[model samples]
Target: MPRAFADITFTDSVKAAQSLYGSRDANRGFELAEDGRHEIGPREAQFISARDSFYQATVGDNGWPYVQHRGGPAGFLKVLDERTIGYADFRGNVQYLSVGNLMGDERVSLILMDYANRRRLKIWGRARIVHEADEPELVARLEDPSYRAPVERGIVITVEAWDWNCPKHITPRYTVPEVEVMLEQLHAEIADLKAQLANR
Candidate 1:
């Protein structure tokens, strides 16, 4: 199908979003000034990092934005310039939802939060997925000691606008050790259930 047709279909799908969300603020509940009053500088750009916890937003085929948690090495996120960030795409279980979204649309958003300090940074940009194996720039960024595998592709985000969120007093919910324990328990439960089914 032509790109225009896909865009038209996506547009039609989102027409009901406002009604479904029950509010006119359908886009992540963020409000942007029309007159471009807010501006981000170099000092502010340096504060956003992957280590602090980041969320990546990509548009589905239906034009709805899907957000996912992004985490890895701190250097996985490179501030190419004051208004650009780049990161490698590591191999996962092969469910490339974000990559699929990028293929159809390059626009994306990233939100990084420093929970301990109650700081949050939201970034909106265009993303380009580089799939070539021998791309020099991608290889250089993947050379960081923290990355265990060679990156198959990289998502380059060119920041268009940014917003800093205010502090909200919320208690910490989970810790690293708790996550591991929960996973172990779930694995054991699955194994037991499988064994019982085998005997049946």
Candidate 2:
């Protein structure tokens, strides 16, 4: 864990819980560590580019935390720079819970998962909502040309800190495309075996 991530996440209550659980000492090392991981690195960029979906959490005016799943084609979430990432907001159920929450509180947290690889990334950031009328070029940049969904707006996040979590207890789950690749390889092997049997 990076110091920046620790700084943002480790509250007094959290520390107290960690102390009760005997993990406080171990976690303190993270706070003292120098690596901040405030900017995206090459490995982070690659992982972020490959993710098709993420869970976004926002705080409502009533103080309730709202979590919503944001998804699109792989790479729909664009990394504008080392410190910025964004996505085009497609029309959904029209509840506008997330958008409304962002208007009230720009602070947001995101959890991106690679279930097949058993990897997860956590991001803390402030978000800005952009309308097409305001920044057409930016909205266009965030949108995926091949995706059929109609985008209503754009959400750009200024990354404050990010951290990769351990894979413990994360069940490996494969996407359809990943399974198809495995099946294709299996079929090729089966054909080769049949050819060998015929030769014999």
Candidate 3:
């Protein structure tokens, strides 16, 4: 728990709700979330690097929260440094809703999930949209050429704080690769059994 998270999440309204539920002490010690804790350490960097896609949320001009899924090859999101992370913003539905929203307000929220592992990470950050013409090198840093998508811009996020969500209700899911691995093991076992029967 980073103090940045506690500062925003443990507000009077939230505290009142906690008190109503007689859970006032439920989130104790989160205030101790410090710079070292909030900083994106090696583990956090590793997790973010492995994510192929994430959900980004921004407040629209009309005050509604608009969430868009951003995706690319694995490790598309570049960990520029401890506090900064970015990704190439590929061409998408021409609405530009998220881009417009970020212009009005830089504050953004992101959710990255590893469904196979039942793990999720929540991030709060300020985002900026930079055009390729303006910062080609920065955009180049984030681009995954193999993805073969037209990158209209680069969305850079200055991480403010991050938190790992609990996995209590997450149902484990397996990807094609994971299933293949299991199938290979079963096939090998079946072959071994057949060999034993032949020997008998």
Candidate 1 lDDT tens digits, 114-177:
6645667766678988755657766566345756775778777766666665577634454475
Give lDDT tens digits, candidate 3, residues 1-200.
Answer: 34677776688998899889988776766766455245688988999999888999999888999999988888998999988999998778899999999999999999999999999999888999998889989999989878888889999999888888999898888777779999999999999999999999
Of 1 and 2, which scores higher on lDDT?
A: 2
Q: CA shift at 165, candidate 2, in angstroms? A: 0.3
TM-score versus the correct structure, for each prediction: 0.63, 0.98, 0.92
TM-score of 2: 0.98
**Candidate 3 clashing pairs, residues 3+ apart or interchain:** none
> TM-score of model 1 relative to the true fold?
0.63
In model 2, which regions exceed 4 Å deviation? none
The runs of at least 3 residues in candidate 1 whose Cα sits more than 4 Å from the true structure, single-residue gaps closed, are: 1-40, 50-52, 132-134, 169-200
Q: Which ten residues in a row have the lowest lDDT in candidate 1?
A: 1-10
Order of candidate numbers by lDDT, starting with the best: 2, 3, 1
Error of 2 at 199 (Å): 0.6
The clash count for each model shown is: 0, 0, 0
Give all candidates' CA lDDT scores: 0.67, 0.95, 0.87
